[model samples]
Structures are given as structure tokens and as C-alpha cells.
Target: MPEQTQDDTGRDRDDDGRARNARPRDRFGRPLPFGSAGVPRIPEDLDLPPAETLDYAQRLLDEGLAFNAHEVLEAAWKNGPFAEKSLWQGLAQFAVGLTHIQRGNAKGARTLLKRASDRLSAYGTAPYGIDSPGLVDRAHTLLMALEQGKPISDTDLRARLTISH
Candidate 1:
């Protein structure tokens, strides 16, 4: 076997010594071989305004790439202003809940969907015109379907992330 590089945590490290996986990932965000073609990655430092972030994440969701959408939402949560942390975090978790459904983890999907709903409920007057209550309803609907063992369709999973202006 070829020699392997070692890091303090046995994970890949970036130039700044931060744990960073350089492996490419598929549409569902599963890591692939180093040289394999993969979906374009969302930057870890992506810092878009709320509207732009929602637009980008919505496009990803429409493409049935919920995992990538989660990455974009997670970046927003990390880089957005502190006041909107819960909002972004809930959106990220919502995307992740969809991802878990796609990956066939119904239990995890249900848990995250419920948690996202709970978080979003606290933001009835969410910023950037996000339909927080709508999202919470969607999460509850999805969670119920999961609990009842109903097969979830792509159309049901890919609801608009924001309301029309």
C-alpha cells in the first residue's frame, strides 16, 4: 500500500490546518474517489445575501440535490449575521431532512424534519420574506408521511423555499 499522510485527527487538513475533505461528492453529497467527476461543490465560505442564498438553494432542491442544498444553507448559517442564526440553521436542517429521506434514512429524516419545524415556528416573522410557517407545515407533513411509512415523492419533497413576492 502507498504511504498515507497523517493529521492530528486523521482527517484531511487545509492550508489553515482546518479539517477539510477534498474528496469530490455526488449530487446526494456522497464522497467519491479523488479523481471521479462529481457535482460542483458549494464553497464552505459562501456568504450570499438571504435572497440569493434562498434562490441558489431552491435551484439545488429543484434539481433533487437536497444534500448540496443543505451545504449552501449551512454556509449561510455560518456566514450570515448572528441575529438570523436560527433561521438559517432551520433552513439548513430542512434541507438535511430532505437529504436523509433521499438517502433512505426515514428515522433521521423524521427527526430533522420535526426539529426544523420547531425551530422555524419561533420565526413566524422570518426575515427576507421567507415563508417560515409554510416551511414548518411542510416539515410536519413530511414527518407525518415518514411516520406512516408513505413513500415520499420528489415533487412533495421539493417545495419552494421562499414565498412569491
Candidate 2:
């Protein structure tokens, strides 16, 4: 088969002379790239150590800003060493699940939260700090409520996780 050629308008003419749109364009008529825009820019001179990543996640949880926390922790998790990667990944999933719950998407929350629990459960709450087990327990409890067609109370959830008032 011969190679087809695309014109400036992104229309390609095959050997059989059929013209087809080769690429999709954005709303402003610019051609969309194949991959994501780009990786988020990380500071080259970042001073915070890898161990502090979980601390940031905890603070996000405390402030009820799970989504942003997930973003930060996920990046750190990916770049972290293999030994502790699962732990960080689990925390990121947990935070994402809580964010879903906050947005009233119990189904989505259940999926990610279950994954988080499963991943974290294996370690038996060793490296995850003092409140780690409580957070996991609270996430599981909320997941059960979501599964059983019960409404979850914000106060109850907070108390279960021991998030101080």
C-alpha cells in the first residue's frame, strides 16, 4: 500500500483518492497535540524532602482539600523509591476518594477508596503514622455506608478519622 499524504488542512488523500480528516482541531481551530499539554512544572530547587510529602497530604486532609493533596502526593509517589511507593500511592488514592465523596460521587469514591484500603492494609499501619489506621478505618466505614444505600454524615466521617475540630 502507498503512503497517504495530508494537506495543510489535515485532509489526507489515499491511493484510492478518498479524502479524510487526519486530525482533530481545538475550539480555536488549532490542531490538538497527541499527548497531554505537558507535565506540571516542578521547582528545580524544591527544598522539601520526600518524607514531607505525606505531611502535605495530611494537611490537605485536615483542611478538607483532598483533590489538591492527591495531585501533590501522586507526583511524589511516582518519583519516590520502590520500597515506599505503594504506601504513597495508597494515600493518594485515599485522598482522591475522599474528594469524590465530598462531591457526592459515592460510586467513584468507593472504587478508589477500596483500592487505597487494599494497598494500605498489607503494611498493617506501620509507616503510616499514628492516625493512619483511623483514616483507613473511616474510609472503609464510609465505603460500607455507600455500598449499603445509606447516607454519610460529614460530622461522623470527620470524627471517625479523628480530624480535630
Leading candidate by lDDT: 1
Model 1: residues with Cα > 4 Å off, grouped in runs: 1-10
Q: What would you estimate as the lDDT of candidate 1? A: 0.87
lDDT of 1 by residue, 1-165 (tens): 122344877677766666777779987788998899999988777888888999999999999999999999999999888989899999999999999999899998988898889889986689887889889989988988998999999888977788886
Q: What range of 10 consecutive residues in model 2 has the weakest lDDT sum?
A: 38-47
TM-score, every prediction: 0.92, 0.62
Runs with alpha carbons beyond 4 Å of true place in candidate 2: 1-47, 128-131, 156-165
Could you tell me how far off, in angstroms, the CA of residue 139 lies in candidate 2 after the best superposition? Answer: 1.7
- Alpha-carbon lDDT, every model: 0.87, 0.64
| 28-92: candidate 2 lDDT, tens digit per residue | 22335645353233232233455476566566556556665676668767777788778778777
- The true-versus-predicted C-alpha distance at residue 81 of model 1, in Å, is 1.3
